[model samples]
Target: MKTLISGGTVVSLDPSIGDLARGDVLVDNGLITEVAAHIDAPDAEVIDACDRIVMPGFVDNHRHAWQTAFRGIGSDWTFPQWAAAMHGTVKAHYTPEDVYIGTLLGRLEALHSGVTTMLDWYHVAQTHEHEDAAIDALTDAPGRSVFCLGAGWGGGDSVDDDIRRVRARLSGGGRIDLALGMRGPGATGIDTAAREVKLADELGLRISLHIEAPGVITALHEHGLLRDTLTGVHANGIGEDELRLLADAGGSLSISPDVELKMGFGAPMTGVALAAGLRPTLSIDDVPSVGGDMFSTMRTAFAAQRGIDGGLRSRDLLDFATVDAAASMGLRDRTGSLTPGKDADIVLLRTDDVTIFPVTDPAASIVSHGHPGLVDTVLAAGRVVKRDGALVGVDLPALRTRLLASRDRIAEAAGVPLDGTWRPQP
Candidate 1:
């Protein structure tokens, strides 16, 4: 199928093609076939991009999609409090059905907000059934994703078998890719981290780690686990040497500024990552405590960085969520920019919206004033997942019912109220 997006302000994010004040894009067979000021495709579906900002869809490099049902549950909690509530209490009550619903809803929300590709750091695999449920949700969703499978709080007894099963089942081929989410040295012991790294390497899967401490990077490097496929998430307190090691090893970082600030994870590592020659990607992390929109993530990152480094550009933050993000997830060759031969994961933001009206600088308008509601159309892999500000093939009312039921059941099982005020027992 061929689709032509015409007459939009194109922010291609590809330096070679550059941004076009008024341009067109052509997608053929799920790959971008052409990106130019004008394209002549006589037999193609025409999408009018007038008064819109056409760009590659945001790529969220890190997110916990399995916690969608727990949104706003930890809004006022610190990191430790959140960990206790989620890992200690709530996750213990989540059934496979709950995992399925939450994963599906989270991925759907990402797509609705112009995030076409996501790296779901799904640490909710309590059982093999739970892992399967998470994969099923991503497979059912329209957007592209990397399912970074990991054992949640109480699910590590048979994690190796479960991981192997998931790899065998879903690694064949599809939009949903497989990755290993490892609890690195800081969270787990060095021996456990080494074993997980070895398992991931043996399985030929990329590894995602939550870098919470300073020496975790050094530990991984010493174990020969700090490679190109290792993505460090929320690298808060790591120093220059650690950053240098990551840069030298070609490892990437995923920073969730909103969650970091809200949960007191310290100042964001955006400036430090950039200084160390790492094009860090932005992420929504867990939407349970904050919103799931990439626009808010980008805006928050931009503001935070600007406060630290006055010379920060809005376009830089935009890149953190777009092209740079795709690269960090090892998806640059596939769907970062609107480059010919790349997958057509694209978004169209309504320039005529009240908040974005009279768009002067396209990048500035998007990074500063844009919101999820301004997303007009979203196409993932040449398929229209969202058009005219509505998601395709999604029954919101049905999803809401399932989500509410799952939340209620999980809350009840956890012995907590449904109003999200649950705390871990002393």
Candidate 2:
């Protein structure tokens, strides 16, 4: 089947080239068939893209799918408190059913917000049943995802068994990509982290590690573990030397700016990383803590950079959430750019929206004033997952209700009330 998205202002987002104006795109069997002006296909279903800005769908590089059920769990807590409460709650009350519902809800939000792809850092899979439940939920969602399979939360010495079990059950099939989530400095010591990273390498799987605390990248560099397939998540404290090592190794970095600022990890993100040849991406770290809004992520990262460094261009911020982010997830070829032969993972923004009105510049308006409501349509792999800012193929109301009940239960099990607050004593 062929689909034509014609007469839209296309932002190609191709790193090799730049945005295009008054463009048309064609999709055939889920891949972008062609991208240009005045393309003609006789047998194609056409979508009117007039007055819309068609660009690559946002790619969220880091999110906890399990936290979808806990959208407002620690809204009023400090970083430490939030961490403690999240750990306590998830450990006690998150069942496999909860995992399924949460992941489905999270992916639904992604589709609704024009995020065609998400790298779900799901570390709450405590059993085979739990793993299957999460996978089932992702498959149910219309959008694509990278399930970064992980062991139970916190430090562990012997994860090889868990890794093998998850791989045996989940991998060797191409539907959902699997990356091992190597616990970062906050969760594990240097030695344990090295073991997890090496294990991922031995298995020939992509690896993602959190770099919350100091010297995490240095530790990885010392062990020669940084590589093309390794993605460092939330490298808020990484320095120039460490970033150089990351770029040299051909690895990638993802920054969850809102989460970082909320947790007081750092001000702004790794512009230094970009300067040193590493273009850091953006993400919604958790849904409950912060809603799943990639535009918000882009804006926060953009403002933080300019606030810290005096000024930053709008194009750079857009890249952080689009092509650069896709590259960080190793999905640049498939979904980042509005290029021919790529997946039709596209988003259409209404330039005439209130916040976006009087658009001085198209890209500038997107960075400064873009929001989810302005996303008129969203397509993932040529499939219309959302249109008019509402999700399709899923009952969002039911999902929201189910998740709210689960959150209350989780909080009750954690010995806390349903009110949104948390903080660990430092």
Please give the lDDT score for candidate 2: 0.79
Residues 275-341 of candidate 1 have per-residue lDDT tens digits of 8889888999997789999999988888888898686798888888888888877788998799999
Which stretches of candidate 1 lie above 4 Å from their native place? 154-158, 420-426
Which pairs of residues collide in model 1? Answer: none
lDDT of model 2, residue 148: 87
> Quick one: best lDDT, which candidate?
1
Worst 10 residues of 1 by lDDT: 151-160
Off by over 4 Å in 2: 15-17, 172-174, 185-191, 420-426
Per-residue lDDT tens digits for candidate 2, residues 29-61, read 989878887789879998888878988998887
Per-prediction TM-score: 0.97, 0.94
User: Against the correct fold, how does model 1 do in TM-score?
Assistant: 0.97
